[model samples]
Target: MNTTTTEAVPLWRRAAAELLGAGLLVTVVVGSGIAASRLSPGDVGLQLLENSIATALGLTVLILIFQPVSGAHLNPVVTLADRALGARHGGGEIAVYAGAQIVGGIGGALLANLMFAVPAALSVTDRAAPGQVLGEVVATAGLILTIFALARTGRAALVAPAVGAYIGAAYWFTSSTSFANPAVTIGRIFTDTFAGIAPTSALWFLAAQVVGAVVGVGLVFLLFPNRKAQP
Candidate 1:
């Protein structure tokens, strides 16, 4: 005879959060890269350091702000992983979340370009080397594992800081600078900058990320066999 008082967030609101969060995340990534490139034109190492710090801080903030609304996926692979593990229900949700992320990411790239006074331009960076591909696989796998492992272990609250720290570390460790999110990778193609990837290179990177996601899912099952995937 008891009635439930908690109501789910409306789909529109959830979608809006995803869009805003993803957009701002990309804006931070691309804008920071641009600023870093200009600020440290001669020192590649300094540029990377600047870019990684900004991205880490930005991601932590975005995840913390939007997590309650839509789980703060901000990445298609994360959404797909949620569905695969039954943490989230419905293919419709996946479609909506992924679509919003991609749209938001593209808008973010354009916005960054405009802010930097650079004309909208496609990336010319050809990051298709074998070493770069290997780096991408490793980077994405590590990222997914970091997120899901915390989520499965009843440490979901730590995901924001953990994920941010992981990405910042991966940037220095991976030759490809850890472009782990598919939507973010696609967005980077719209701008020729320190962080951008050529359109052709992005296709290969996406394929590697998908493979990495599968590896990460398998590892999650292996490591946390008894827990439900709850990201």
Candidate 2:
């Protein structure tokens, strides 16, 4: 979610937490997707429902567990948003966080593949359709708005649940199934399972996410111009 209040935590420890959290978060996503495909067979809708529910609940728990140490900014977009919103993180720290997240995400996907007995192969699932790109923009934008809106309003306590819920709903509402986080998106590329995305398609999604982040930050400034000073 937000990392603005974790300045006291050493940068290395924070980065480790981010890595673990991001890794586990992707494990939940990719693992659930694989499980759902097996559990639901031909029913794509049912598979998505199972996947979304698992991801939402798992993410909430991960955030709760890691937030104290690292603020649990598992997504690069979230980390960047924290910096853009003046969260006291320097460029170096931001790079560390993002690097850890990406590395962890790839590890998570590999773990999920190994656990599911799936070969570690690049995904062939192409998701570069125009509608999917649009879906990513909306999904990423909503995700940023949701996280910062609560953080700036001093409702940081709600970030875990709210983010979980938003992503779960976005899975159904958005055509791209709400791969809102760039780290997670990249991770999915390592698995050829149900949740995986082709590398070529990932480029479009990553770009859309960046654009969405900018739009989201603009919206935050528009709606919550004055960030409440933390005690």
Candidate 3:
């Protein structure tokens, strides 16, 4: 258990580790979300709540599993932002991690879609209404900011429970009740089912999520005031 944060681990190995970690997380998030969506056919609120709860549990497990290997940064914005903020993970490694996460996420979504037999319409169309965009932004920003703070505080292990718990609660607290990762967002499109976002509107959500991630980084700087690099 050489968990020293400064030394660079093997790029290929880290990439592979993160890919599997993120892929498993996305699978459970989308798959269990499908089950929740089917449970509450008409009640959008209930359905969203179920999706969030399942996602939180899934994320918790992923963090516990992958924290040692790749920091479990399943989101591109998070990987890049952490690097920029003087974290130990390198830029080249971040790119590989992000790429792997995207691939794994897409694969997970496809599997979930086929497993649940989701409708094509749900996969191709934008599910995020314009009215919900603000929540999407604030919620995502809050998540990223929290992540930075946790990392700086040397509480990376808490990320899993925190994200999972927050996502589960976010469904009830926020208007959008959406998962904010771009890879996960796009991956959901393949499922074309309960957790799916339309391909057409995916870019806008992606942009919003990135914006939120930026805001989160800024917030972390203001709140945590990192004097030097963290791991």
Highest TM-score, which number?
Answer: 2
Superior by TM-score: candidate 1 or candidate 3: 1
Going through the candidates in order, what is the number of backbone clashes in each?
A: 0, 0, 2
Comparing 1 and 2 by TM-score, which wins?
2
lDDT of each: 0.85, 0.93, 0.73
- TM-score of decoy 3: 0.88
* Residue 171's lDDT in candidate 1: 93
In candidate 3, what residue range of length 10 has the lowest lDDT sum? 1-10
lDDT assessment of candidate 3: 0.73
Where model 2 places Cα greater than 4 Å from the true spot, the runs are: none
Give the poorly placed runs of model 1, Cα more than 4 Å off: 1-7, 228-231
The true-versus-predicted C-alpha distance at residue 174 of model 1, in Å, is: 1.0
Q: Give the per-residue lDDT of model 3 (tens digit) for 1-231.
A: 012262466778777877787677678878887888788888877877777777787787777777777777777777877776776766677678789988888888777767788644447646567756777788788888777777777766567778777777776676666567877876776776666677767777888888888888789888988543345
The estimated TM-scores of all candidates read 0.94, 0.98, 0.88
State the displacement of the C-alpha of residue 153, model 1, in Å, after optimal TM-score superposition. 1.0
